[model samples]
Target: MYYADAAADNSVTAYDLSSGSRTVLCNMHVQELTLYQEKLYFTCTDGEKRTIYRMNLDGSDLESLASCEDLWYMTIYKDVIYYVNYENDQYAILSMKLDGTESRILRKYNASDLCIAEDKIFFAERDTRYLYSMNLDGSDVQQLNSTYSRCINYMNGQLYYYGSEENGRNVYSCDLNGNVTGKYTSGAKFLMLMEEELYYYDWDDVLHILPLNKKSEEENTSHGTNIVSYKQEDVLKPVRSYLASNWAGYTLDEGNITKQGNTWIILLSESGGSRQYQLIIDLTTGKITILCTTEDILPVSVYLYDTAPSVSPSAAQLSEEELNSIADTWYEQNYGPGGAWCFEYHDYDGNGTYEAFAVCGPVMGDGYDIDPYNILEAILYISSTGEITVIEKDVRDTDFCVENEIEKEYYIEYDGKGYYVPHFRSGGILWQPMYGVKDNKPYDTGISGHISLDNDGDLLYTPNSGIFMCPECNNHVEHKHILAYDETSGELKSAVKYPSGEIVN
Candidate 1:
């Protein structure tokens, strides 16, 4: 037997009739509660979120079973607790084990007033305004009766319910097979059967006791005193802790931290090497698994540094066709005709010789350049089986003119080997230069240059400040403020803001 009390002092308590003792189930702001197997289950609404808790009959072992931003009604059956989750924008029936494991949605919509019968479940749905029943496994579904009800219970060979439709609220009893026997006079909102007495709460906020068979006035009053009393303000605190310890790590590079089930899995790259280590921590058992040292593992060097490598987004997995397409496009953009002549030191040929290819074509431009042409460069790889590689080359102009001088030239120079060059042309004139070995290697030292372009197609030499352009309008605008472009039919817009509190468009 169970009852809820919210005294004038705002304390809430739930009483167990067998022990004739009351326990403070939830100390917080609880709006609803139910009892099963001597454990008190209740819903507490804290701010915008609601959490369901379960505790021992003595209010000792309290634990939060499930939580969500919006949870309405709850009922317990077997080893699972089912509740109505309202935040999903649909009526969803969710269930979780008594141990707070495997919480998942049971069904969606067509759900109201849920009750667990002997091996069967009953509920009222809005669409049909009928009472329905189904096996505990959610199969063999069938409608029991047509009515608008909120609370339902199945005891012995009878079904008891209370609901409101056009005529306020009333209590009704029916057989297990959906045959309504009669309606009781009491206007009860919830009903329960205990010791052959119909225990229910009336609309007057007072508890009522009705016998299965008509009883005398004295018997009715005597049965009412047997119902345990409790104060609603008595809050119950659970026995278990909720928060987890903070995670500590040396670096975040190549690190993967994820939660699986009740365990946290962490895969981290070892310091100063490509090797990685794995750690698994179980929250329930308080166990940790660490792979520190293992056989058949090679020892790598490590170094301490003030700064660590910044991790970029992991590369997406691509199929063979996708990889081939991407490689072909990249090759064309970097080595095709009118493209940049940059050489990538990959094993393009099966030959053991790590040869160099002077690619001449139009490649994709990286820096600020509108329709930028391709440049040239040399390539070298560490070995056929090695991962590291190098690129080297130099760029030189055909003419010795001052303006033609390659100033601000960007060349892909190796940290160890050669350098590459950039190729630019105009008209039918050809400006190809001959290569020769000098100083034990190929080198260039005439009119080599670099160039930087602004966001606009205009060229800029030694610009004092970094310029940022609006991505949408392509306008060289300030940072943060919106700018409208008169060109492009007023379709162009940019954001520009000065270091001061001024905005310009």
Candidate 2:
């Protein structure tokens, strides 16, 4: 069993129920627990910091993920972890990949106990108690109902929730469209909705299992757990034919299609080591577009099987001269003729080989461009073995380009081995390297590019103050104390302000 004993100790512990042994995986105070594919991800607090951290099953190799003020109510589905976080001062629904990439605000409202089903995210608001859902990519959100439900769970194909209706609190079942199907039972001090049984304990602490239908307990054990095998169903031959006819010579995995507005997004990949494809199709126009196919593998002292040469081994490793030759060629191609470029020299992956980095573009072109021509871009890491891994993203995003300036505004933090080498903590950039505190100065993130310290000079993780046009209010919103980073301790720290124009430790 994996859980957090926040009352006893602010720690997440994994227990071997059979052996009756437990190990504390982390020291942070957890609000939730999730175990997926031998990895544990949870939201926790260290002082004022509200952040997410991921670790291996054996309680080793822990890494910090995304952080925000008022970060709470988190859950994961597929590769994305959804949570309620502050976006422009308003607590809103947001999501990021397990590695803390692709962070986006799904909707500008506080939601809790999120459950994903039928290709959509479902949650309820705490204030008004309205149930809502949206597409996986934070699009096409809709209010399902106004039922004041909590501890919401989805089983089979229906939604089960606890709420009050005429005579008091009860467990009610609702369809995907949010219509009441049936009331299961009442009195839920604790509720667990499984595939075969609904278990709950009352104020007396007596656990009761209410069987929904006839099923063996063995089958019930396998239900609603992580790592379900993707049982391949028969696909329409025409759909397979369309894929084979279009991609031609590439074997496609099972295609899952979901609609956002009028565009249908089909997410699958070629059976290659480079997990690099986000394919999309439009049902209304029958148009197909290859949206994103950027390279993903980091060439280092480590080379994946197919990308490696069987004979020469690392013998044919490109010399710095040869790598510079390739970098020069790419630079001239991107900037057009006689553009002198110098790169930061380091093994960004820390794999004993230098990656010739350059801020070159037209690398990823956005389809939803403002002018469909070109956009300012960022640096690309050229490996010693001639593979280029994108430092920021593997694909083009207009909105991301607007917010993050990859070439300059962002800084790199390594895994504590090398000075300039970058590290990817959980496959995303290790640290969004904070503006560190300068020598005896009030550091403003936007101005000095250094983090501000409290009077104690302890590291802090806070969002730099800025303004962005709010989609909800149509007015600019001020970004508040985001999340702070403690570089010395390599921990996520929250900022506490004092009346004397100071921050706290």
TM-score to native of every candidate shown = 0.38, 0.40
Off by over 4 Å in 2: 6-10, 86-89, 165-167, 201-207, 215-505
Q: RMSD of each candidate?
A: 30.0, 25.1
lDDT of 1 at 235: 7
lDDT of 1 by residue, 138-174 (tens): 6777887886666777666677887563333556777
TM-score between model 1 and native: 0.38
- Model 2, span 239-329: residue lDDT tens: 4555565566455444456635223445556665445455443221223345445662321111011121233223335566766665556
Candidate number achieving the greatest TM-score relative to the actual structure: 2
- Candidate 2, residue 176: CA error in Å? 0.8
Q: Pick the candidate with the highest lDDT.
A: 2
